[model samples]
Target: MAIASMGTTVLDCPDPRTLAAFYAAVLGWETAQDSDDDWVELEGPGGYNLAFQRSEGHRPPQWPGTEHGQQAHLDLDVPGDAREEAERQVLELGATLLQGDDGGRRSFRVYADPAGHPFCLCYPRPQDT
Candidate 1:
């Protein structure tokens, strides 16, 4: 068996349509052509995509102190020099900055969406490749 490439990333939301719309606005992608009440998909750059399913009574994650630990997180890596600009964009798109230790030790900040999903903005580090 072999994997081709990333098809989609699905998230559970109390309301799939709303969550999908939120992401669509942020990502500047349109809703999937075949979207339904139960699920929605947003296309990503070069056909990468994200899907959301309607989940009843969904509970959002609690981070940092973790009364309920994050089941998963999305790490968004932006160019080191563009991290600040990207952070501004994310905030304008309705994500709340959840944590920041900008004292120079860490080079990333955590943010939460309107639905409380935690995602991180990481400054890319130089790599050999």
Candidate 2:
């Protein structure tokens, strides 16, 4: 069967430009389109495109224990040895630790972006022997 590629991943946020800027800095992406207040697009690595939509009264997702639930989240790729520094960098960039960093028991770390959208900085999973 022929396969298809996902065009773009869109997220809902209060300010499209602000959200786009945050993502651009995090992912080292460039803004492809952000000339309007209602929508903004940040060009991602490869063909992956991320668009932020202006969501009125946008309520950020709650990690479990809540009815809102996690709207969606991004799992960022980070080298195993670089996770520590990455954690520090993301925190400085306004990410709030959500989970997986309480005692470093997990392979991945969870954080919420400036707009309260959740994302992760993960060490690459090892291949099964």
Candidate 3:
């Protein structure tokens, strides 16, 4: 049997509540449980789960050139016509826009959550189907 079973991704933050809320909104998930102030979880769309744990001295990562560095990132796919609106919604939900490129009107934009974890919103590359 394999050791990994696609459980959950845990992120350490100074305040679990804040991080959990941010992710809950971002992922369109709801808080499934709040075991304590130090621990919280959001129920994923399917069977996935995301948890946040409080750390006394948590330091957010810095990305790119590493003035601060990133520990991990998540990518989400959006439809071409709705990409702009989705980006706006994510930013409104507390994600900081990082960068994007012009790939003939369809592209991916990188962003960082409030906890400094990087993520991307992308439009699927044109396929030959």
Candidate 4:
């Protein structure tokens, strides 16, 4: 028997609604809850729910190791050839690219959302035939 099921991922940011909106556009998800200014959620397909919480002085994490470390990050995948378009879309949706296909052998690109939470756009790994 299974012990648990999946649940929503909650993030902390300065503005919940603003952060949710940015992810909404990126994931094609819609706002699930917005009763208060401190928290909001976006419901995406496949039972994925992303929530945001308001923090009084939310200092975004600085990736690549600084005094502040990366707490967590989200990973979204795209088809192999769709990487370029995906990169453009994320950029337009307010994601700042941290690292990308700079002619490297890496399979994923790192970015930070509007609230400076690090996330990644990755190409799904190939399946074994």
Candidate 5:
């Protein structure tokens, strides 16, 4: 009795192919065969899909501010032990850190993609016993 099932999540960017490649690298996904210049799709594991579409006047959002604030963002999980390596990989893959460790207090670090969309690399919190 649901209205519809899940579909691809699309991000508007200046160049679809380039953005798609970036996400593909970050997510370890593969580009769909039907992707093209104006629109590109990535086939993620578990039937999930992510896509990028060309926008002539795309403006990346400003995080932690009201002006052009974040419309949406992805929260990717990283194991506690691999957090440093994950951060290194993302930074090498064109992600810029917006916020980082606060004396080991926070469980997540914020970052912006090459196009300035904000996303977080979240680490698992210690469970109380």
Candidate 6:
């Protein structure tokens, strides 16, 4: 028997509502009815729940460095052909590109959210390349 089933994935941020809003917009999710300023939850697709909690002294992780290494990250899969468009959309949505802009020749790109958390937009590798 399983001891416990999976629950929401919680992230600590300076402002829960703001971070939650960012993810909601990026994922096309809706804010949970019980969300508040200190704790906000997004109703993610496929019955998954992503939540954010306020941390007064929150410190964002530093990408590609161990000073404040990324404790966790999200990998959003995008079609190889649509990777460029996805990159543009994320940039417009307050995401800062960290790497993988070599004329879209790479299979994945890294970006930092408004709160400075690192995430990746991944593309499937070509089978016959």
Tens digits of per-residue lDDT for model 2 on 32-61? 844478888887667889999999999998
Q: What's the CA error at residue 61 for candidate 6, in Å?
A: 0.3
Which digits, one per residue and each the tens of the lDDT, describe model 4 over residues 13-117?
999989988988888898975537888988888898999999999999999787777789998888867888999998998999998756646778999999999
Clashing residue pair totals per candidate (backbone < 3 A): 0, 0, 2, 0, 0, 0
Best by lDDT: 5
Clashing pairs in 3: 62-68, 62-69
- Per-model TM-score versus the true fold: 0.79, 0.86, 0.83, 0.88, 0.94, 0.90
Candidate 5 residue-wise lDDT, 1-129, digit = tens: 999998989999999988888889888999999999999999988999999999999999998787999999999988888889999999999999999869568889999999889999998756511
Better model by TM-score: candidate 1 vs candidate 5: 5
Instruction: Report lDDT per candidate.
Output: 0.80, 0.82, 0.79, 0.86, 0.90, 0.88
TM-score of 4: 0.88
**What TM-score does model 2 achieve against the real structure?**
0.86
Relative to the unseen true structure, what is the C-alpha lDDT of residue 63 in candidate 5, on a scale of 0 to 100?
Answer: 89
Q: Per-residue alpha-carbon lDDT of model 1 for 1-129, expressed as tens digits?
A: 777966788888788888787677666888879999998999878888889988889888888767867788888767787877888888887789999836645778899876778888888544411
Candidate 2: deviation at residue 79, Å? 0.5
Estimate the lDDT of model 2: 0.82
Question: Which scores greater on TM-score, model 3 or model 4?
Answer: 4
Write the residue-wise lDDT of candidate 3 on 20-116 in tens digits: 8887776788887545798898887778888989989877777675776776777787787777798888888888987774654546788888877
lDDT of candidate model 4 versus the reference = 0.86
State residue 100's C-alpha deviation in candidate 5, in Å. 1.2
At residue 97, what lDDT does model 1 achieve? 94
Of 4 and 5, the candidate ranking higher by TM-score: 5
Relative to the true structure, candidate 6 reaches a TM of 0.90
Q: Using TM-score as the measure, name the better of candidate 1 and candidate 2.
A: 2
